[model samples]
Target: MAEVLLVVGVVVAMFVAYNIGGSTTGPAFGPAVGAKAISKPVAAGLMGLFFFVGAWTIGRNVVTKLGTELVVDPGVFTLESSIAVLFFIGIALLVGNIFGVPASTSMTAVGAIAGLGLAGNVLDLAVMGEIVIWWVVSPIVGFWVSLIIGRYFYARFNRMVAMERSTGPLLDVDRSGPIPIPRVHETTNRRELVGTITVVAIGCLMAFSSGTSNIANAVAPLVGSGELAMDPAIILGGIAVTIGAFTIARRTLDTMGSDITELPLTAAIVVASVSSALVVFLSMLGIPASFVIIATMSIVGLGWGRATRPVTVPEAVRKEKAPPVTIDALAADEPGEELPPIGEEDPDKIPQASDLFNPATTARVVLMQNVVPAIATLGAYLTFRFVPIFGI
Candidate 1:
């Protein structure tokens, strides 16, 4: 019976890891793949490799936190209870996918574990409190950092990172010897090649950050239960995530690249860098940071900051009339074009923020994202506390 239950637990953990890869790959590599900087297969391959590197290193800290420290007793994570926790997380992932929203795997996983801890009377308030505090603080930091960049440095950074892809293949295979060697095509200039490499490198960084923070979301419970050792659990989760990257991630790459939000490549890079850095920092502290929330706030802050650039602080304080708030500020200046002094740009070019994003739609997305995790918490709690099946 124990062996069978352990098998069930492993399978559920894999399911959770698979969804993590599918959802996270887009955010990590979408911009690079979308920009034609890298092929989807290459992006997926890089994602898997870097993800493993992260999970094997810094990710262990997060697994330890969630699997042991978050609860008063690790024994609460019985194989049966662990499966229930994973089930709730899997449901959250399914809901996010169906709604065309990428949910926070970290938040959902934490919620489920918290629920189990609460039901078993093993909840550690101090640890949960610290995690919650970071959750609130990290996104705000991402927003502000992105906002400052968008307002002051974005134009310059954009100009530097911008690339116009020239015709011809980026690389060619030379079959001159027994082993073929790949070389940059002659037509690909230095600037374009460098830009391409930068984009792909940023994608790898995002993938590494994702692995650091998200691996625990898949296997923490099993590890906590002592059914699987930490190294084996991490390896299993990494493999499942890699499978997901190669499979379902193709659709996400399309969605992130073109559909959900049309972030300029520069803006995508900015957001990815800021959010990935914050997530890595949090993961180092054994915190499961919410990449979705951080990235969303970063996008909003970048747009808002750019939009507000038409009004200088002094002018606004003096009650000088300013242009309406708008995200169109992002497009007001072309990459590499000289930006006018702050508050000097024509107001006529910027559209209202409402034009870029509908409040109703935005509210719905934010609400639904929170609601899914709440459901996971509530459902897990109910199953453990009220139901006798899990023996909680």
Candidate 2:
């Protein structure tokens, strides 16, 4: 019975990992694909490769943290309970996918395990508190960094990162020898080549960050139970993520391509780089970082900063300041109605970019993202505290 449950737990963990890969690939490679630096297949391939590398190198710390530190005893992660936890995670991902809501898999995984730990009377408050602290801190950091860049440096960065495509292939491959070598195309200039590489490198960086944070979400429960070793679990989860990148990620790439909310190339790079670095840092400390929240906050910060920036361009005219355009400039000549104050213009009439970022809607979206994890936590608590399952 234990062996059968172990198998079941690993399978469920794989399912959860697969969904994570599909969901994350769009954000990781969206810029690369958007810029035509790489196709969906190549993006997915690089995603799997870098993801595996990250998991092998740095993801083990997270496994130990989730399996041991988050609870008083790793022994509480019995095979059946691991399966149950994975089932909750899988269900959360499925619901998120169906509804097109970007739930945090890391949050859901931690919630389920924390629920089990609490029910078992073995929850480690200090460790959980630490994880929670990082979660809150990382996003704020990403937001501020992105905000500064957007407000002060976005235009220059955009101009620098702008990629223009040439007519020929980026690189020509010669496979006549035993080894295949790629050389730059005759038509591909240095700027275009560098820009192309930068875009794809950022995609791989995002993937590496995702792997660092997310591999734990997939197999931590099973590893905690001692039914699976860390290396094997990482490898298995990597395989599942690869499967997702190849299969379901194709649809995600297409959707991202067509989405109106897709970030511009420079903005995407900034957001991805900031958020991914934060996630990788937290993962190194064995914390399950919330990549979704970090990315969202970074995006919001960038947009807000850009929208609020003052016009700094001085025209080619005299070295004097330009007159401000006020609402009085639009006063009706025929009517005697008094013009409203300069700052009192109707908000609807102003085409402000900030209007698109409705705070209420963003709050609702964030809250909704947590619903699945909340449900999982409650369900795990009730089942373990009340039910007579698994002989805990």
Candidate 3:
């Protein structure tokens, strides 16, 4: 029975680790991917490799806490209880995936453990409270930090662009045709060296931080249970997460990168840095956190901060001024505009891509990503508590 339970625990841990990679790699690399700095496959591969490295190295501390420290009495975590916790977490992750929500494996695992503690009548209120507090605070802090950093970076980037424009074409190019290429004489060795160093530095930091912060999620459970040695668990968890990064992380990355905000490369870097800091801090506190929530909220907050003006539409449409009344205009108009000819269209149009990053849309997408996961967490908690016949 002990051996069977250990196998179950390991399997569950692997699933949790995979889901962690799927949900988190986006936040780690989405911005880079969005900015075209890295291809999706390469981003996923690098993210996976770094996640494994981090898990194998500094992730042991978090694993230890998850396996043993959160609950009051270590003796209460029998093999059966561990399996039950793993089962609940796995189910929650499955549900989140089905709904296209980027749920945190860390949050689900924490909730499952807490639920198990309650079921076993060994709930540790103090530790539970601490975890809850961190859950609430970390995302908020991450959001604000990202907002400030994103704003600063954007400001600097715009200023740089303006300076370049004023300095007379940084790239000397003949723009006579559809395709334009820079003149060879325009290229400078000094500028090329600086650009190369900057790109390399950003890539290294992004990969390193991603790996370090995410390791906690993959190995925490195994380390906490004392069933597997910490080092081995980290290795296994790292491999699992890396595999997941390569396979399932791309979808979530696209959702975060393109759907959340139209982020410039610098803004994306700011978001990544803020998110990594928040996750690492929480891991140090032994508090399980949702990287999905952190990254999404940060991006959303950045969009909101930058959206200085509210969207408004004209209150009334003058019939004559509405341009040749017709069924098409009547159908397209939201309440006020009467009609216009189908063929008569406004040649000067507001681009749809510009509206993609509008504050309302950003808020909606962020909320959708977060709310579904929260609901899954609640469902997992309730199912674990009341579904007595299943013995979870």
Best-to-worst TM-score order:
1, 2, 3
* lDDT (CA) per prediction: 0.86, 0.78, 0.58
My TM-score estimates for the predictions, one after another, are: 0.94, 0.86, 0.68
In model 1, which regions exceed 4 Å deviation? 177-179, 317-327, 349-354
**Model 2 weakest lDDT span, ten residues long:** 325-334
Query: Which of the numbered candidates is closest to the native, going by highest lDDT?
Result: 1
**lDDT tens readout by residue for model 1, 1-392:** 99999999999999999888888898788888887778889888988999989999999999999999999989989999989888988998889878877778899999999999888889999999999999899989998998898889888887777777889989999999999999999998876887788888899999999999999999999999999999999999999999999999999898777752456777778889999999999999999998888888888888777776778878768868654544456655665577888888666767654554557766777887788888988888898999998777
Candidate 2 lDDT, 1-392, residue by residue in tens: 87887778888889988988898898788777866778999988998999998888888888789888899988999888888888888888877777767778888889999899989989999999998888778889988887777656665566666667899889999899999999998999876887788878888999998899899999999989988999899999999999999988888887775662435666677788889899889989999888888887887777654543333334213424332221111111112233233223343432433243557867866886678778888988887778787555
Task: Mark the 10 consecutive residues where model 1 has the least summed lDDT.
Answer: 322-331
lDDT of 3 by residue, 52-156 (tens): 665555555566666677767666566665666666666766766676565566766666666666655666788778887887887788877655543334344
- Which 10-residue span in candidate 3 carries the lowest summed lDDT? 324-333
* Model 1: lDDT to the true structure: 0.86
